[model samples]
Target: MIFFLIFCVTSGFSTLLNQDTLDVIYRYVQKTPFKKIFERSGSEASFINEAIPTAYDSRAVYPNCKSLTSVLDQKKCGSCWAFATTGSAADALCINGIANVIPSPQRQICCDNKCLEIPLKQCDYGCNGGVLTAASLYIENNGIVSDECIPYEENSSKPCFTSCSKEGVKMEVYKGLYAKIPSIMKVSENEMKKGIMIGGSIAVAMNVFQSFTLYKGGVYNRTDGDFLGNHAVRLVGWNDTAEVPYWIMINSWGTEWGMNGTCYYLKGKNLGNIESQTVYFSTTPPTYHGRQVSVSFSLIFIFLLVSFTAVLYLLSYVCGRINEGEKKRDLQEKEARTQMLREIGERRYKRGLKNRSSSSVRRRRLSSSENEDEKDTSTRMIDDSEEEEESEKDIEKVGLLS
Candidate 1:
């Protein structure tokens, strides 16, 4: 059953990979004015560049507090909307150091049933896209929506649909299939280093090419490829200083995107704004959500009684087992330590014996594998050369006598 379901989902997602679909989507992006508008606005990127302080910061708040982990995919999928909304939520959580790892954009994209907000017509999965901020606003106003309620889906397959319903949220409108991700570009070593040092309101530039499909660790060369895919990253920190510096940037394409789990951007200049951006946060949470879940005091008392009893018994058993395990582990560790000491002592004694012995010179010359191989090769060559010399000398003496 699980395999069948997995197969169905995989097949559904694969449908988006149709060549005609891809060409159409690519054409749409190429023809779209959004990229061109953003290109002209050096100061304000259409999707990102407008900077602001993080949401949780009380001192100075900026509009468009986006998720540090959610990159601006623009018009990629309905998932972009989840990304936008979650980015806002994550900004609030991250700035406060409350939590990281923004909730899945997949969840919001597939699950939220509020159609009036998330129009059913425009967001069917194609190369076409939508906004995430609206959906996040809905979640904030309403309670948690379960994946069981929603299920994982491929937006590229069907037109975006409201699969689940909530009592608090209405069908008239849901968050769009995408949202704007305001970014602060860190283009240079100086600016990037400052963002890493300060660690706030920083967006790192990324090149999304075919090779960027699966990222491993290490510093990469931006000059190597065309940098076909453009995205923003969150600055984490700097690594090296000896030759050129490396900047640690967090990618929103899950932990799978770069540097094993991170990416290093070699320095460039004014690729985007490293300074001059601000962020914002909501002062009050949305009305339907944010309030604590209601539970009766009567139920609470009974729950407390049962929970305390269970916990007490569980702790006692765990403690008793732990104590027994510790006793055995301590004995084993002591035995292992003693064995190690004995081996060390034997090595020292052998060293002393070698030093006192006449054969110490031979031992000294072949201490390691590298020296041993060299010695063997050299010894054979010398022996062969000596035999050749003796044969030549004997022949010369014989010739002279003859």
Candidate 2:
């Protein structure tokens, strides 16, 4: 069964399963104006001008940002905007050496109503899909807590709790600063590379099609598929030398789907308008609200080293004790076998002696009986002869006795 499943995946027959997931994705990504009115803001210009490179990867540059590198699933909600915004914010924080905090997409998606309270008419569309740039704006003003704060609920209808973003129990506050950039201007190979080189993930949206859902590996180029809907994703890096030269994107469909929850889109092609619309975020320094212990990477490394040494020592001790027990058991078995053999030999010797003694006793009894019989016969004969001689004087009595 597993082999059949693997074969189906390899042969692209798993599109049936992927179609269902894509349907869910399409249904939730409700239409929004971000794509219509997206424009590069003043805040993003400085970051873009800061760095320029040919090729770059966030994982290579910032190893501490596991929250940035790891794949996340938006599930059956239209919260890709929140996920992308929060994800980029987290990476920016790590790159800037602020905090390795995975900000709550749930908070941004469900609890971020600060925009609603604003009179500027800037507000999130909620689960019906919102603009990453707009959401980043709200998050910047009112900092978001960690993912553990609220925890993303797949059901969008779930009420946003006020007590969700708690300190110590959940996470510390991670502030955000929004920067919107026109993805079209950076569609050029060098332009995108320069944008990515600055630091942090790039929040971008693309027209997700049927073929995209079934992407297993290799640089994906549009071959055949109808436009489904606009879906948000985080651009981490890109490969320029592939058969199709693709941008390595972190998808939100869980790690099990789409190249282990990541996909490669054709770079420079801008298929699905991916290169035309992208957003990036900058993070302000973190502010702790309550008592919390933020362990440094050095401390974590030391702890791991100590744990590994202790485990190695324990294993060595256990193995040594096992070897000793095996040796002792082998010796006991050898002694038991020797004792059994000795007992068998002694029993055989005693039986032989008993049999020999019984035979000797029988022989002696037979010999004595034979001698007695012969003596009796001789005495009878002599008595007969004496009786015969006496019979001459009193033969009648002797003859009568014979």
Q: Which is the leading candidate under TM-score?
A: 2
lDDT of 1 by residue, 103-173 (tens): 44455554454432111222222223332223433444442333333433445444444544334533332
Model 1 regions lying over 4 Å from their true place? 1-88, 94-101, 107-152, 156-206, 210-215, 232-234, 237-243, 252-257, 268-402
lDDT of 2 by residue, 1-402 (tens): 644543444345223322222211221221223222222234444556664544567888887787766887887788888888788777777787877777678877776654322112335666888765466555555666777777777655656656654555844676645343433233555545654555478888778888888888877788467777878888988876556677878888889987788877788877878887676655322121001111221233345556776798799999999999999999999999999999999999999999999989999889889889989999999999988788686866667889
lDDT agreement with native, every candidate: 0.42, 0.64
The candidate 2 region of ten consecutive residues with least summed lDDT is: 285-294
Root-mean-square deviation of candidate 2: 23.7
Which ranges in model 2 have alpha carbons more than 4 Å from their true place? 1-51, 113-123, 159-161, 165-171, 183-191, 283-402
Best candidate (score: lDDT) = 2
